[model samples]
Target: MTLDYRWLHDTVRDRFDSDDAMEAFLPRPLTPDELKQQGDDRYLSAMSQRVFRAGMKHSVVDAKWPAFEEAFWGFDPEKLVLLSPEQIDGYMNNDRIIRHRTKLQTIPRNAQFILDIRQEQGTSFGEFIANWPSADIIGLWNLLSKRGARLGGRSAAGFLRLVGKDTFLLTSDVVARLMAAGVIDQTPASQRDRQRVQDAFNALQRVSARPLCQLSAMISLSINPRGGLKFQTQRY
Candidate 1:
């Protein structure tokens, strides 16, 4: 049966504009004051990536996240580089996140690549992320394809776009929400792109507020099944 996506889109549109609206539509994370407070930490970006990965593992692919986490060193970029070939082979045979060998092998190299960018750019991780360089559709697609190391190419791209990667204009839940809200016609295939579109629509609606992390949680709650949104739920 075909799924209707209008309600999901509208819900995202209405809530993302304001904290209260978002809270009313979803759940609470950081209070208003906390969102207002800022530092040089890339905690939000890191958390967003984690959420994207976990969501891909659990919701999209029905994999065991806990095992994935345990096997992958908490998704730490630095630690991932240390994994041996045997470990990658083991992960392939295990019943965890997508066990694609190429994806697994790419983890460490990808981590190293990011680290190289971080050093070469002379920017903090947060700053580097905040200034992601993607202008058009192709650029965004390439950026996502590259960043999503261990995830499948299309899935990685979708996840990046969903989590507000600056290049693309798609996101899974955001597109679903947009479809639900009647703001758009077709459901975007790329989750990341869908999210970008939702953010753009939210901006047009004049519902801007601080604390995107909190809003992220709200978004997750609205779309993800119960117990599926928690970051640490899948204990390693």
Candidate 2:
């Protein structure tokens, strides 16, 4: 049976030492203007970091980010978009960075993708992320998967969370809550399942008057009490 968001939030609150502790644990949602103010290079860098972190040890990727910044020219989207064929080839043997060729190639391609968006929408990539409706976040995930390299499944959602875009990540804890609430019968794999998840979150957001980020955290805390599965919390 579906529970009211108040019940969910209280359940999470109960697990904490105090109300202040709960508040400190949850992330603050970014406003549209705040999101827009983030530089393009920061967005590109975050995207690339997420790409590299997938299926790899996050600490390892993070430890090498400085080399990545130096090698990739501080993740400047314009500069990356202008990368020469020779420069792309050189990274394969570069000892300074992770030499995974496929992931390496996505950097410039994603840079071009960012530039394309600016050209088409006349807004920065960060603004584009901020302007997307939270109610249709699954649709935003689909768009990112199609338009941005290496941003499918949870990666797109993770990227949104990383940038403080006020969206939810469909992590296992959230999925479990969704299933328990009768939102879905199984893991959300099909388009219909994804839509159901989105609708469920939209309903919760309306009922709770909470941003998707806090709602996601609430669901997670409700599941594991001590906190959900451990993962890297470092922001790009």
Candidate 3:
């Protein structure tokens, strides 16, 4: 029910010889105020980027971001939400941005999702995301999936992580450790198992007072040989 911070720290430190690697294992998430202050455009850009990252190389996707910014009108939720169906369809042949029509379509659909949350909640989209409780991050994930197009499951989780939210990723390595720790029997394919995993991280957070992402990384590095994380650095 409890994870030893010392053990997690030492476990990772023993593997990565660079003294700074463990210290930088996970990016420093923004404070609530910082989260609240971000523009919705940034959120849209980050969300769209995650969608592109799903099927392409990070370097390739990143290199095209400048064109994406231009093509999507700087990811302005209000503006994007108003794009015509024909206008969205028109991007299918555009070389300036990723030509995948479905991914291009998420731009306008997710833009509307952001605006809806702002109007319904009577706060900025950033504020709405910032106000979400970290302990109930799964709840936030569910909300995003239910409301935003192409944001279900892992896409929702990736978006949250990109926006500097405090949450854990159920990566393969983390799942392996979760199984080893008796948290679950296998990959959390069912909602019930996912909830159980969230509860486990919630408990560990209560005990260790650590960020969930860091805990996930620690769990990832906790398995197998000491040098397992040589190529596993997570970028912010």
Candidate 4:
């Protein structure tokens, strides 16, 4: 007998509506186990990014961000300013972090801009963070495109979503999960994998209207391989 694709799709969609349903459908969260299997360094980095992003989203002022700020010298535009041209040349030889000469140079300027925006808005740093705009797919695409950000549109969207912006509907690992679940046929997987994931997610919206993050996480966990979902671990 031919499998009813529509029924299969609907079943998958229904299961993704609730974590309880998802857990009932699958024994455990799909991706975490796989990630744990990867090894300490990889797992730790991935967990760190996830935790950092979550803190950023919830406006947890005293979390990983404090450490990040302290390490980067307050991320103050003036205080942790970008490296000078001479300093940039020296950074090329330093082995501290990935040395993107241009980005390193832009860091101070970006910090300054962030500071200016904070001051102009007349908000405390914590408030500014709490009220920061959700980096939805379209907004992030526009923002990154204007700045010539390294990643493509979908990749940027995924990164922003991973960082706690709930605006985007889907992410790369989520898309992989969907494909695994047989909810959607695989097409040319590209940097825009997040968009594909979002498309499937939006299709489900027609059935059960709900928050995007809740839906995305449910769908992702459902379809994720035995290995955990792959999230972008590094910021720089």
Clashing residue pairs, backbone N/CA/C < 3 A, model 3? none
TM-score of each: 0.46, 0.92, 0.90, 0.47
Kindly list the per-residue Cα lDDT of model 4 for residues 93-173, writing each as its tens digit: 755443446545555544444455447777442343334343234544454434422334344444334434344334555
Please give the lDDT score at residue 97 for candidate 4.
Answer: 40
Model 2 lDDT tens row, 197-228: 78877888889788878888788767866525
lDDT of 3 by residue, 6-52 (tens): 67668767877676866665446678899999999999999899888
Q: For model 2, which pairs clash? A: none
Q: Cα lDDT of model 1 overall?
A: 0.46
Best by lDDT: 2
| All candidates in order of TM-score, best leading | 2, 3, 4, 1
Model 2 lDDT, full chain set: 0.83
Local distance difference test scores for all models: 0.46, 0.83, 0.80, 0.43
Off by over 4 Å in 3: 1-6, 16-21, 224-236
Model 4 has an lDDT value of 0.43
lDDT of 3 at 65: 95
Better of 1 and 2 by lDDT: 2
Error of 3 at 229 (Å): 7.1
